[model samples]
Target: MIPPAVLRRLNSLTGRSAPITLHGTVTPRMTVLASVSLATFLVAGMAATQFRSQPLPPSNRLARDEALRKSVNQLEDQNRALKTRVQTLQADVKAGEDESARRSGAAQEVKAQLDEQKTFAGLTALHGPGLTVLLHDGTDPNSSVDKSLGWTIHYQDLQDIVNVLWASGAEAIAVNGQRIVPSTAFHYAGVNILVNNASRLSGPYTVIALGDPPALAGGVGNPDQLAELKSRNRIYGLGFSWLRSTRLSVPVYDATFLVKYAQPLG
Candidate 1:
């Protein structure tokens, strides 16, 4: 319906007014979004690498646990050894105490036996009816003197009296308070009579003999030794007396003598 030139110009206007379409290439906004996405991905990867390189706390914790376990094992072993040692020491102490008690009991038994033996042997003092004989030195003025006689009171006179008293079954005897035992000795030392290793026996030498007075009196009556003792007493101014009493006490004698051959055997 229009002219050719007009139609051409109307078509041109219509084409200009219509929207254009791109079919072969991407847009600038799409490229920019892709680049941004790639950069974000690289940053995330770098952060993961740093985290992997750092040390973990659990590794140190495991090592500390292992060390603690070793220390506990050492402590347990030490405790076991100490327990064993304590047991050994306890046993030793008990054994020592037992041995001590045994020794103490043995010592007490021995002491009791010794005491009993001493009692049975009559090793203690005794007091009963007895006889006493008195003798004096011839040189003393307190003695009786007969100028016509000759002999002096010698050591033999005292020895004879002691022998007669023993023969009369005297239980205990003492001369001048010197107790007569089986080991008692009489000897002369420098013109003096020594009894039991002692001297200076002078006037009023009282000999205590513990026994039945009647038996002792019968043993000494009218004996030859008595006649000789009387003769000496009259001749050389010696003194003599004999008496009987109801009670006279004799003391115990304790003596310790060394033995050369004594030794301890294993």
Candidate 2:
């Protein structure tokens, strides 16, 4: 044990402001216990800090996953709607194309019909293999074959021949370069033979036909069909001749038709 005087002297030598006072005598066992308590305090502080910085709980994570799933569903629904819109647009486009094609086809059909009507009306010139008939006054004009001028070619004879040609499938006919149509007339104006109302025809008349060669020739030369003409041709030598041709053309009907008493049927 140090004396009071010695303690004061030690404190003065160590540069202490006050003298050290030992409340109780310190032992090695007590020093060791103080150090272990300080270590335990430091470890508990570090564990609390780590817990504060941990990940979110399971409930919070589940809510976030559900929000993401809803977003995906909305996007899928929008995708389906967009696909349907695209299909609708495509169908409309296809329908428009079909309608355009149908209109084009209808126009083409009408134009085809107009062209056929023009052909039938003799407004268009025709060319094909056919025959040409020639008719003139009978020979031996003073022979008095029947005294009724039966040897001469008349307007009635022309009409008969025209009818026969029509019946024989003549697609087109022209008498003296005049196209014969449905409205054509074969009659006599006084002594002169009038054709188509304005045109006059004389002896050696020419009849141009466009059709099958053998068929036209056969129909015209049929002995039973043209019996009277054949008889006149044999007896009085009336000029009745036909020639086949590989290529023949009929002129377009240039005469204007006067629709005085005619009307459309339908």
Candidate 3:
């Protein structure tokens, strides 16, 4: 159907009784457009009413900013107080540590002195000009025919020799390159001599001692140890030889010991 505006123009031009349906001259496209416009207006009115439902006071930017600033300042004051407390605690701890450090330093110095004395007492390894004593088995390749006569030096020989050397001016001693303290031991494991329960030693057994050569030589001049030594040499034909050297190295004691009954004496 034609629109009313177009029908009116036609009536003015040709003078017909409006060539449109009695219902009106609304076209299908025009009717759709009018329905969409009416729906849009109703939706817009509903949205405006919903927005105006909750009317608000005017914006107060300055008041909100002032409140935020107050909150920030309060938080900063709390943070500052906590930081000050932490600093004070740190200072107190530092003062206590400084006082304790003085005593700790003194204790460390004492320990260093004690360790040096122990090292000098042959509790640690040392190297210097000293002497070496070689104790060999009496293995005469040309004349040994008796099987009962064991031509080897026993542990007793080794102990006696060490005692004699220590009684002399020998400062330090080692058997088979093993350091000897008062706790050192020598025993027979089958046919081999075990030193310090760690190393198996065989002849010729080497005994190294560190001391002043002149003092050691003069002090070890007793012939009683010599007679016992000679008797063994005559009976078993054991070999004994000693030499003073300008250089010798004594090793550290590597054996472990457990002391269940002893405590440190003040």
- Root-mean-square deviation of every model: 16.1, 10.6, 15.0
Local lDDT at 216 for model 2: 92
Candidate 3 accuracy as lDDT: 0.76
Candidate 3: residue 60 Cα off by (Å): 59
Q: lDDT tens digits, residues 1-266, model 3?
A: 44566445445544677464436577788877765665576567679878899878757997899899999999999999999999999999999999899989999999999988786555788888777887888854455566644467778778887888888878889998778887778888887887777778777888888888665555444565656666667777788777888989898777766468999999
Runs in model 1 lying further than 4 Å from the true structure: 1-122, 139-152, 198-200, 254-266
lDDT of 1 by residue, 101-200 (tens): 9999999999899876653344677789989887776663443654532344566777888788888878888777767776566776665677766445
Better of 1 and 2 by lDDT: 2
Give lDDT: candidate 2, residue 137. Answer: 84
In Å, residue 205's CA in model 3 sits off its true spot by 0.5
Best by TM-score: 2
CA deviation > 4 Å runs, candidate 3: 1-112, 120-123, 140-150, 219-221, 234-236, 264-266
Give the C-alpha miss distance for residue 204 in model 3, angstroms: 1.0
- Report the Cα lDDT for candidate 1: 0.71
At residue 80, what lDDT does model 3 achieve? Answer: 100
Worst 10 residues of 2 by lDDT: 1-10
